[model samples]
Target: MDLYVADRSFNKLGTVNNRTSLRWVRRYRKTGEFEIHCPATSQNIEKLQRGNVIIKPGDPEAGYISYRNLQEDNDGKELLVVKGQFLTGYLNRRIIWGTEIINGLVEVAMRTLVTKNAISPTNAERIITGLSLGTLMNYTETADYQTSYANLTDELENLSNLSEIGFRVRYDGSTKSMQFETYKGLDRTAGQSVNPRCIFSKDYNNVEKQEFTESDSSFRNVCLVGGIGEGADRKLTTVGSATGLDRFEVFSDQKSLSNVVDSVTLTDAQYQALLQGKGSEVLTQNKKICVFDSSIDKNANRKYKEDYDLGDIVTNINNKWGVRLDTRIEEIEEVYEDGNEKINVVFGDEAPTLIDKIKQLRKG
Candidate 1:
């Protein structure tokens, strides 16, 4: 894959050549990232600088250059390494300034969050030029969201995962603008007959290598949400119905969500429903994780981008292990090295990393 460099203004600088290796990663519910290693030539060094943009042909998202590292081997051969996240990462730089409540469609709520904080914000100084919301997909799924002074990316990812919808910020080179939109992947699992099914298995010679993980070490099925008030007066709600040995209970503090929203007081029933919704959202973040990691064979029956892409629900079967999973493609990593390319796909919810744990703690 060829890589091109662009300025912050979206002006094409030039193409990058003689690159040693590249790792381009894309995700369904979160911003993607990329890393590049190239010889420390004058042109390469000049092109791969911090604050510049990296573009890949046919890729929906463009990367933002934020880091650079220069290294020299024993033979005195210098190498320049650069890394950054996709255009969607721009949201990470901003936060929800104040309390924002949504009690309707999930798509509208996401758009509102971006608009109120990034695009055309109430504070004109905070507005991000050239950034706009794309046409809504008009999904009917509804949700109740209330956040104050929270990370925009985290909130969006939470909503996306809860609704099984994907969000992206794509750069339009011709228009020189960025568009944010929500999307849902096609159901290509065996249970769905409307679309052609995509299955990866050793029997089919499509999976070059595979690793499956099923763990409940960090799982919590039941969440007892404690809302405003103290002791017995505290509004309480529970999510999940698992009982006996299968039940794992956890507490979620939701004191910030009040009965009043935008100066309008909700009835007791409405407030109770809101608390329940928040409990459900909390449970989603602390549920069991079953992940399937696999390397796909290029010459396999199903193609990469053409057949199945990120966010699509696909099937993975291992008769020997008695495993059959139909899960969404959560992430795809493209590695290009030594003039060859390899693709790695992750299905289902991935285990949280150190950074993820930090974010969760911060939210708490």
Candidate 2:
């Protein structure tokens, strides 16, 4: 896969033909990233400079050059290493600004947030040129979101996880602009007959290697939300209906969700609804996690991108282990080295990182 370089203004530069290795990672619900290692030639050093952009073949996202390094091997061969995030990472540069209460279709709400803060804010200086919303698909999923002083990307990711939706910021070469859009992958599982099913298993010789993980160490099924009051007057709501041994309870303190906004008081029922929403969000964050990691064979029965792609729901069966999973493709990592390419796929919720654990703790 040849890599092309572009300037900050989206002007095309020459290609990097001497790259030794490239690791490109793409995600369904978050910003993607890439790393490149190449000989430190005059052209390589110039094109890989910070603030430039890297474009992979057939990829809509562009990688922003943020870090660069130079080193010499034992043989005195100079090497240049470049690393950065995809265009979606630009959301990290701004916050939600203030409290935002959303109640509507998930896609519409997401676009509203972007327009308010990034595209056409009340403060004209805050607008990001060449950024606009793409045609809406009008997905049927709806959500209730109330966030304050939060990172734009973090909030969008939270909503995406809860709704099983994905988002991206693709650069349009024709318009020389960026388009933000939401998407849902096709259902290619055995249960669905509309589209051809994609099942990976040893029997089919599609899976080269696989690992399965199931854990409930941080799981919670029930949440008791407390909102906008103290002691006996506290507005309270409970989520989840698991009974007996299945019941796992936790508390979510959302006292900051006030019933009165801009002098208008919400009805008692409205206040209770917000509490319910908060409880539901808490339960979602603290659910059981099941992950399936696999290395796919390129010549296998199901072809990548054609039969299935990121965010597509598919099936995985391991008869010997008696495991069957119908899950979404959450991430795909493409590794190119020595003129060969390999694909690593992660299905279902990925293992949480140190920062993820910290965020969960803070929420709890």
Candidate 3:
């Protein structure tokens, strides 16, 4: 492998081509690209030895203590000599989101949680984000009027200053409804810090305009929404459905008979994107789920996204009949480890901030 030039010096340049090979240099003779032929066979690229260390700016001047240590010469070694393809295995074998340990624990818990006498919903919520936890949701809404709007505006501003909170919108989209929500932080602990229980995502759309959406539409009105949160309360629950929607259900298809979601389907690209983006990836969508968030494209075939709203973050997205337009957002937290101690802090969901966006939407 040839040495790339960031400057005349051979330092600062990272190694490429061979994943296992390491590189080091003592001095730069001039200010130009340096060809690094193999030390053994001048034609072959030179490789650094495993465990070799390099000295940087400050140190005992020599040896591999820290890169910061300055040296009359440079030093470093390859730690791992992984041979063969860089990729280890297929999706089926992947652990995902550092959740190898997490999955095992979750599986055991779920078996116990799903007991015959358990209080699980008949119609379950499927997370559009396909989130297990640590997901931020952005939602939109309108206030009653007047003083309420002003109050909400102030609250939103105040909430923004709080270290725990996060945001994306400054009053755009949803001529009638407004957008607001929370962000899921970089990791799970950050998610738990929100001290949250429910996402409380609600939207209003025209009653008509229905077509294919979700992985399968025959399921019709039935769609995968969100699962229950940790701190869900029984009292003061806003969902006052005189009709029967007490239990959450899952299904393979929209068929009235098809209930109980057995498995979820996602593309390799989508899956990798999520894994790489740290679960903060775009919402998984089919025609059945309508989304609003950055513009949306089913297959890059329909790439024309209008000044989209929160609905754009959705997939197979439809709105409740009586409501007008609105955009949404999510609540997220901060996560970082402290000297062997883990820390998590929640933010957003400030009732105060909700009042401000309500006021903004009410404005012309």
Candidate 2, RMSD to the unseen true structure: 1.3
TM-score of structure candidate 1: 0.97
Please list the Cα RMSD from the true structure of every candidate, rounded to 1 decimal place. Answer: 1.2, 1.3, 24.1
Off by over 4 Å in 1: none
**What TM-score would every model get versus the actual structure?**
0.97, 0.97, 0.16
Among these predictions, the greatest lDDT belongs to 1
The local lDDT score (0 to 100) that residue 264 gets in candidate 3 is 49
What would the per-residue lDDT of candidate 1 be over residues 29-133, giving only the tens digit for each residue?
999999999999899888888999999998889998999999998999998999999999999888999988778888899999999999988889887778999
Worst 10 residues of 3 by lDDT: 83-92
Q: Write the per-residue lDDT of candidate 2 for residues 1-364, one digit (tens) a residue.
A: 6788998778879898689999999899989999999999999998888988898768788888999999999999999999999988888787888877777688888998899989999988878778899889989887766777788888888788778889988888777688998999999998889999999898999999999999988788988988888899888888887888788899988887888866889888877776776777777777788888999998888898999999999999989999999999999999989988889999999667788767766654
Instruction: Show model 3 residue runs off by greater than 4 Å.
Output: 1-93, 96-288, 293-364
TM-score of 3: 0.16
In the range 211-276, model 3's lDDT, one tens digit per residue, is: 221223311222232212233421111211123553322221111111121354444333332232
